[model samples]
Target chain A: SQKTINPNYSNRGMTLEEDINESNLYYLTNGIAVIHKKPTPVQIVSVDYPKRSAAVIKEAYFKQQSTTDYNGVYRGKYIDFEAKETKNKTSFPLQNFHEHQIEHMKAVVKQGGICFVLLRFTNSDEVFLLEAKHLFPYWDESIKGGRKSIPKKIIETIGYHVPIHLHPRIDYLKVIDHLYFNQ
Target chain B: SQKTINPNYSNRGMTLEEDINESNLYYLTNGIAVIHKKPTPVQIVSVDYPKRSAAVIKEAYFKQQSTTDYNGVYRGKYIDFEAKETKNKTSFPLQNFHEHQIEHMKAVVKQGGICFVLLRFTNSDEVFLLEAKHLFPYWDESIKGGRKSIPKKIIETIGYHVPIHLHPRIDYLKVIDHLYFNQ
Candidate 1:
């Protein structure tokens, strides 16, 4: 049944990555927000062109990233974020983030960008948009012998739950509108 | 001498990539902007651990990129672009750009993000930022039997010349302030 459905179509129960991408696309098309996934860059060393239409990369290496995975502007405010999914329902580990990423988020917030993390609990099918201001104390506490992670309970208290929808899939901007605009 | 110099020092005479990166770093550190170079993603098929410190990537494949190389938010506006260099002194061939990249830039522009190309004529030691709106027609014209490329002279007429500087390296934000902020 999944095979019979359109591969790129939005209606087949999307993953968190797919859902966020679809929601961003909806936002873009409707002129609501302009967010994009930065391209995954790879260094190519060798390629085999066995056929004109088929070029196979034979050797390559992943380069260290100097930036976040997603960023853009929303309602004249800079928004920067990274998304991660975990199967565990109990706690979200600090180890999920890299040192450079934490440093990057701090820089974004300093520059007045609305920085956040999108955490998805796959088993429970829940997603939350947790702002960086809330994340900062925990990030620092992480170094001070706090739990090596933020428990799901804290996330539930501070972060806004992004609802899943049939049309837009993630529909996170709606939550943004409510949290940032309506308030 | 180059090795003894602190590669990360802001005051050092950095290379072109270094300048762009440091400018981006300056933007990040100052909270004036949030821009970054995306990581190159590679599919690692094999790895060898001959030494504890260095993990040699034995086999890998370069992954195709889905978007432009650099993008971020500045003063609440999304900025997206690709950086390119050419040895040709007179003309920059259109073939250097992929169809997917053009499509990606178009999408960003359509979504109200500032989209453009940061081109460098290495031979002439000049760099220019050419807007997408100015480039699209030329791209179309080239495909339809007009000039197969955009000459440096034409670019000089249309593009905003990015001034070289000590701190912000590329110093494209100055051009942005003049074009968008002044308006």
Candidate 2:
């Protein structure tokens, strides 16, 4: 018997979320890393318990988060980061990060944890791992009448380019190993 | 004019969640540690934007998490744990923990992360920090037709009693420092 798959499903593009999830799953399965994206926070206003099964939330609102999207343990060290995708061709906008996230990253860095941002250039299909130390200067400079966005050339120079791999999709730990772990 | 305050609000007891949050905040502000409760995972089914200040989630369901409730960086090490309070005085039931959470703790342990559970006995007004290594054997025993609950006597012997404090409320990290970090 021949099974026919939906063409529309096959034609769907993989979002950054899906790609990272797949990569995290790969890392988890291989015992390489234990990073996971935090679930989207929601404020539940009301709930309805319809008979058996489970209770259904009748009303809710998406809540603002005070930290980054992803965090976990990597090689006995705390690894924390946020991932953002930009369609802009020239530079990556700083507006993608919230003030609380910046403060959170600063705290993580102060605690001697690895803190970074995974920036994806959608136009070029390139991903770069930018450290929080590098990101903070741009964030601080923006308030000091500096450029609100980081130029691509600067990112290309300072940021480590994450190689895309078949199993992990984004072999980010490879970059982390090379840059931080002296591998 | 004197402002009237509700006595009921003042008399209300603080939950375990509030206690932990307050403790984490104290830890953060004092530069002692960086720990946070992961936001409750919610599955958003529908959303509506009625030209408002914020988008409202019309329909959603609370999702079960595979990981523990709280995790963060402490002394350059990954700290992961779940906090649970029980009314039962004799023992802590294994049913409080899901299989996936057990698996998550196991993974964190394997990754050299400090993993534990903060068990609070509501009736006794006592809290204990039980390490994952201590927890795993009991969980494994349950599968082999053993007791489904960890005896309070056993927990009292194996787990370190977390001292309650005024500002932080539940200072479990102090126990962690003593037990794991040798401080």
Candidate 3:
């Protein structure tokens, strides 16, 4: 089987996460921001401490993250968000998000921290930034057995389309500056 | 040997970490702030997916944290800090901190985020809130074969004393209010 890499984002030969990480490094080195992806949460059940070697965890289990994946300070404001890439072209399924994550987003909003979701439609090679405030009502309706996903068109209209760039890859912060800071 | 609980802070039956955690929870539930302790980072080596149960990690190792233990949003300001407790009544060892963590704090401060350290002298039953900027020179000097620790009196002079409280436990935010916002 052969795979064709989309020339748009594939120029760097990176996944969405790698692109974001590289962009974050760029941000960090340039004194632009201090955002970081939190490490995967794990539950250690057993460990062995040897005499000469480092301690090894013999048994552990993955734990569902209680909060959004990425968080940090940017321009004197607290920033937090979750990023997900979907192959679905028509709509981005609500199932891509977890319940507790929504709750966490609500809390972050209440604290006046910036919160949002980054939706990458891989099939279309496009990305969008949707603020958590705009996303809440749809999530509420979703729990009441409404539309299981937000149509791509609606996302295009309501969300800020994040244009991919060479140096920073996805310029989500540019979208953020336009939306939150009136820049 | 029976552990004696000090009436001052031990009345709540919590260590410095637990006290901070309970306080964070208090702040979160009351809509005051949103802070979280980052999960301990682990390097996963192998895993097994048994069809019947949750995936189990067979081999892993604990990794040194690259940043501070705690961070979040408070009063719309980005908040980040490291907390440590010491039984040494005369001095707090600089060895308790890592180089990368200090660099991370420096970057955070440059971004205008509020960064500090919570120093709990367990034997003396005192806690102090020391800004990251104040601690940096000491760290730099220590690296150049200067004093290996910060004297307790110097800490008391430069750091704001955090009075223990029943409701919020540490009342660090109060110190932040005074120091950062001139509350």
Indicate the docking level reached by candidate 1.
Answer: acceptable
Clashes of each: 4, 0, 0
- Candidate with top lDDT is 3
Q: Which ten residues in a row have the lowest lDDT in candidate 3 chain B?
A: B1-10
Candidate 1: which stretches are off by over 4 Å? A1-15, A22-34, A39-66, A73-77, A88-90, B1-19, B29-31, B41-58
- For each candidate in the order shown, give its overall lDDT on alpha carbons: 0.73, 0.85, 0.88
DockQ scores of the candidates: 0.33, 0.65, 0.83
Better of 2 and 3 by TM-score: 3
TM-score of each predicted structure versus truth = 0.77, 0.92, 0.94
Worst 10 residues of 1 chain A by lDDT: A1-10
Off by over 4 Å in 3: A1-7, A11-13, B1-8, B11-13
DockQ of 1: 0.33
Q: Give the deviation of candidate 3 from the true structure as CA RMSD.
A: 4.6
Q: What is candidate 3's lDDT per residue for A25-137, written digit by digit as tens?
A: 88898889999989999999999999999999999999988999899999999999999989899999999999999999999998889999998888767788899998998
Q: Rank the candidates by DockQ, best first.
A: 3, 2, 1
Clashing pairs in 3: none
Error of 1 at A96 (Å): 2.1
Q: Which should have the higher lDDT, number 2 or number 3?
A: 3
